[model samples]
Target chain A: MARVELNGVRKTYPNGFQAIHGIDVNIADGEFIVLVGPSGCGKSTLLRMVAGLETVTDGEISIGERVVNQLEPADRDIAMVFQNYALYPHMTVYNNMAYGLRNRGTPKDEIEKRVRKAADILELSEDQLARKPRQLSGGQRQRVAMGRAIVREPEVFLFDEPLSNLDAKLRVQMRLEIKRLQRSLGTTSIYVTHDQVEAMTMADRLVVMNGGRAEQIGTPMEVYERPATVFVAGFIGSPAMNFLEGRAEGGKVVVNGAAGLAAPADIPDGPVLVGLRPEHLAVVDGGAAMLELAAEAVEPLGADTLVHGRLGDGQLVTIRLSGTPTFGEGDRIALAAEAANLHFFDPETGRRI
Target chain B: MVENRPFATFVSHFVLILGVAIVAFPIWITFVAATHDGVRITQVPLPLLPGDQLFANLESAFFTGVGNAREQSVGMMLFNSLVMALMIAGGKIAISLLSAFAIVYFRFPFRMGFFWMIFITLMLPVEVRILPTFAVVANLGMLNSYWGLSIPLIASATATFMFRQVFLTVPDELLEAARIDGAGPLKFFRDILLPLSRTNIAALFVILFIYGWNQYLWPLLVTTDKSMYTVVMGIKQMLEAAEESPEWHLIMLTTLLAMLPPVLVVVVMQKMFVKGLTETEK
Candidate 1:
């Protein structure tokens, strides 16, 4: 319903500790944007600032063309679902969902109608609506929290790790439900999570943050295929991308303890960092192998086997192979990567080339 | 208790029964004395068994009145005590609830200073500062009135501190959520905090009611009119009649009447009292 924009926003505490250092993101109307990072990386802080829960120390946040830095959270027309499902424990599920509407002085029949509709959409039973929050299971409490937000029909919905409290199976189920709900409602939403998988699956575009700065903001596939920095390449992937210290000289790359590897012509002759995705590496014939790995350990997942080993230069690498692998511990495996799959970064700055 | 160890259970039950007997002996004696006529109650070694004169003695104590305090009946004294206790309990809970809410939630200047100031009053109870308190009440022309008896003992530091602890345990996100729901401070207090602390309030009311009921010295000093006399003070007046023998049966009956309301309060709110003292549910 509204496009939310953050223009060089920063949050500085009174004691001189800075939490968020200048983040800017222009979220389009009805687009779901996710802010994902490790804990203490200021992703939550950024979301809180936009929600008007925290004061913006610098820059402007405008939602629907109005600067909202001075507005209260309620005045900004945003509803947030907390990580712990911050439902009113003493009130029944119906009152918990209708509290905001009642506070806004909505008519009794209208409030009841909206509440019933939200509960129905959330799949909460009629009997469950009359029960208090403590009586509901964890997932049902989460639905009540979602119902509370949806009943308001606010312009923007903010979710702060709402699925993190549920069990694993419920988390997955609720994740799909949330995505489906957002698609049907077409409300502009900003979700914050420390889990990269949640961010990748839920966001129209993901803002991968580190140390209070947006390291990369792109669609999941775009960020995965073309990481802007070594940190992004490492943080966004499961099993993580492996890095090796190497040098590019005279149109060839010489990695430590390996035969000469192919390099793009544009790469300058200097010390560089090489990145290779685990799944991108394939088992090749011995003569065509780009690097020989001294196998150290093996983890056989049902669909794919993970081979963790050390390259000859003593750099550890993990290789994801389809199906069961014939090689076990202490067996050398010949692995090779296509020229396009190798990602190069500068050794000094860790920026991708 | 259900461990299937018969000897251990027997020992524990024996100790509990012994404790109950020790505590209940005086109350049992009071009941027995109330059952006899005045002359029989004053006889040697006192009566250990009930007599048929219990109704006669209760009627005399409830309607006709006791010696030396004959101008006002025992029923009137009980009414006075009831009013004072209810006022004190309700007033203390209200004032302490507001003060505690202010101290915990607001960030005014010198907030902790104000809290410690209230905490310091715990040392200066009515006995310690009775003269100044009585002087102030007398100057305000509240002597021989209900306000003089209840108001002097209403501001409770213990109740304030207890409420502060209860408020502190409430999660911060609840406040944040309520704020986003557009509730102002007073609305939040009435709708959220009061309901959340319901058990604690009930528990504090029970204790404060007893405290107000048992007040003797302050009520004795303030009320000169016979109609203003509290039940506890009336019992002492009954025992101190100089010219004639005390009405032992009537005094015992009045004492039994004085104990009823507080006992009723404790019994009625027993579950909430235990829960309030033990657990803080979210």
Candidate 2:
């Protein structure tokens, strides 16, 4: 139950390699904030700093009101669940959950009461509690890991790609479990993950990071609907937002060898990139003006479909369709996105125009 | 293989018999001799089977009245040997574990220097510096005591090296997880590191037990009193008793007695030793 804040935190290795650039963000108490990005994006490093597992080379990290820059992890009053679930392989599930409490000298009966309560919430039976970690399934081990964190009733919870190690089904299941657990506990949680769906579904607010800098921080829908930067737009969505080279002039954007389209208000006219979400690709509904392209690949996933194709200037792009289109590879198609759905970016700066 | 198993079995037995003889014949010699009359047992065609003089010799081992020299019983000598080996083994293993725990888990100044100290010890055997070591120990006022016998010999640089290597295999996530759970350095060491290293401890135990049991020159140098003699010293004494004409049977029997503790420790902890060695490679 604490707000976590990072004030211009920076981390640099001894050999002069800086991994986390100075970044600042504040997590309000009881908010589930996710740091999402691709591999090597430094999201995990930032999370580890908050967890007090990694040292901050510059600035400060404070849990609630206390600046914990020099505090040990134990003194930080935070609990973290790692991607691998780092269960004590030698201990029974009960002992694994009770270890931190026992370390704090919690009375045996009280420890048992809290451990049993956590186990009940996680749906771990007495029989399961008696079993060692290696005997349990992957999901069970993860729950035991959560149970360990939950019993602490920590001020803040840090998850470093906690569900990344689980299979697809279990990842999804645990995703819901973590969201529910956070909601019930009402503790400030900072989760790091590479998967966008997990971020979108699980984050109360999503902080998308790139190359050691946070690109944007917003509610999940806000990031999805109005990505602050081209990178955020390209990274936040799957079959990511496609970009095509273009130029803006006189309130209008012109594609190379293509029709003129009116630019959004506030677009600067030197050089621009047209950002298009695949789902916005309006396939010719028989009456609308269209841009024709030849489909290169058709991936039908039953509910929706993705059409990967090339435009007139041989610019490669992906088109997402609502219904399975009767389209085949090498077939010609006409598609157009609505003017409102078009996202324009300044070409030179790669920032939203 | 099962249908003609007897023919296959005979082939197996043939190889197995050769292996067993190669591995066990020396042991057979030791055991057979440990149970015989000191004079008759060393004849050219040594007895293929054990002799019946075991009880009398055993009695004589206990009865200093039977042997020409006044000495403590071989039983008392073995007890002394146990105390020596256990002290050395326990001291070295415990110290190595704590030091390894520090080196492997904690980050501090001169970490590499501490590691190099152990590595240097492993690289240089004490035999090269025996006289200086004796001088040091004697100057420390530890002469004629277990501390004198145990201190120089308990460096256990090799065991510490092995433990550090084994400790390197533990996942970083485990340590991070423990840290996040509010376990500090001491609790982490006691609760997680120590428990997970059961196999390594057993492995180190066997290795140190053998090392301590077989220790000779240091113990021989420090322990001057006949009562303070370890089993190995007693065995060497039996060999030197007659000087020019040594008691080979007594020497062999005493040597066999000297080897028993280590052999038993190994047999009991063999599984852990193998696991400890192989798991580290993994």
Candidate 3:
């Protein structure tokens, strides 16, 4: 219901460890912004700062029009779903969902109506509503957690890795459910997760973070198709983007002791790193092969076969091909990628060329 | 359980039985003496068997009290002991819970300093500071009152420390959830924390109740009025009276009554007590 904006938000712990450097992100109303990063990359810290759970060492956060840097979490009108689901272990599902409404002094009938509606939306039956959180299955507990947030009718929702505790299958189901729920509720939500897949699928506009800084923020397709930096290029894809160290010379990238590869025309003559996503690489016929790889291992995943190997210049590379591939270990395979699919970055600064 | 060795099992059972007998011997002797007449109780080695005076001795202890020391009924003393024990137990749990919640959740100046001051009281027990504590109670004009009997002993460090440890084990996420739920401090304490620590409170109540009921030296120093005498200290008065005129049956009868409440509490709530002692949460 409200747009959230963080202007130069930072978090510095009391021990003088700066977990989050200054980060500025403006999320439109009803947008799902997923902050994705590896461990200790300040994604959770940034989310907590927005939630008002952690103090902002520097900068301002605004939920709607009011700057909420000084407001308490309760006063900020936001509800957070924790990674552990954090349901009150002693309270039944009905009471847990009703807790916030009751605390806000909503009328009793209104509280019951909202709780029942949320439970219905979450598909928690009457019998399940009476049970404690410990008695519910892991997926059901996660639903109740979402139900708790849904009944709040708050301005924004904060999910702190809410689906990380579920099994693989359940995580996918809940991920879709959460996406549908957020769309239906039209609530601005900020989800934090270390899993890039969750970030890619759930985020309307994803924020890729690295070393306490926002590396890139854009739509999933945009960030995937055009990653801004080497970190984003390496992090966004499933098998990760393969990087080859080469020098740019006269509008071409030359790998030492290997054949020269095509580079984007705008890239200047200097040390550059070439990135090619695994899915973008194709196994080519003998005559048109652009790069030769010595296959070290092969993973046949039914839908896509992944070939992990070393390139001619001794760089580790992974190539993804559709359906089953007949490639075997130690097979010298020729692979080719279109010039438009290639990513170019500077070796010194790791910035995009 | 892993290996069924008959000889080892037999030795374990035999040792446990021996320990039980050693502990129960005094209670057996007290029971035997209470069942006998005054003259029979005063006889050598006491009566090993019941002597038909059990009901009579119980009635005398309940209605007319033991010997003739200050003429207050043992029933009245038992009532006083119950009041004092309940007050101490309830008061200690209430204060310790609040203090523990404050110390664990809030940030303020001198917080650790105040916690350490409360902790320091553990090193200075009532036995060590009896005179000054007695003076404070007497100056408040609370002598011979229930406040005099319980309040001075209610500020417990052990219960506070136990509750603090319990609160620390609670995940920080629960607090964040509560805060987002719009629950202020008091509501969170009532609806969440108090319920979670229910078993611990019951267990601590058992311990603190027994401690309060068994008080001898402090109650002996404070309550000069016979009506205010608790049953445990009242037993000492009965024993002193028995020195002049042997009323061993009546004295033993009062001693039995004094020990019954705490024993029954432990026996009845044994499950919760064990759960509280061993496990913090499900």
lDDT of candidate 2 over A1-353, digit per residue (tens): 88888999999979998889998899999999999998998999999888778899999899989999999887899988988888888888999888888877889999999999999999999999999887888899899999999998899988989998889999999999999989999999999999999999999999999999989999999998888899999998888998888878788788755677767766666778888899888778544644667899999988899999888888888988977787689998877788878888776777777
User: Interface RMSD (Å) of model 2?
Assistant: 2.9
Q: Please give the CA lDDT of all the candidate structures.
A: 0.92, 0.84, 0.90
**Best of the candidates, DockQ:** 3
> Candidate 3 - CAPRI tier?
medium
For all candidates, the clash counts are: 0, 0, 0
lDDT of 3 by residue, B68-130 (tens): 444899889999999999999999999999999999999989999989999999999899999
Off by over 4 Å in 2: A285-287, B1-12, B38-45, B65-69, B242-252, B271-282
Angstrom error of the Cα, residue A250, model 1: value is 4.0
Please give the distance, in angstroms, between residue B280's alpha carbon in candidate 3 and its true position after superposition.
6.1
Q: Tens digits of per-residue lDDT for model 1 on B187-282?
A: 888988998898889989889999999999999999999999999999999887778899988899899999999999999899776776564457
DockQ of 1: 0.68
User: What is the TM-score ranking, best to worst?
Assistant: 1, 3, 2
Ten contiguous residues with the weakest lDDT in model 2 chain B: B62-71
Better of 2 and 3 by DockQ: 3
TM-score of chain A of 3: 0.97
In candidate 2, position B95 carries an lDDT of 87
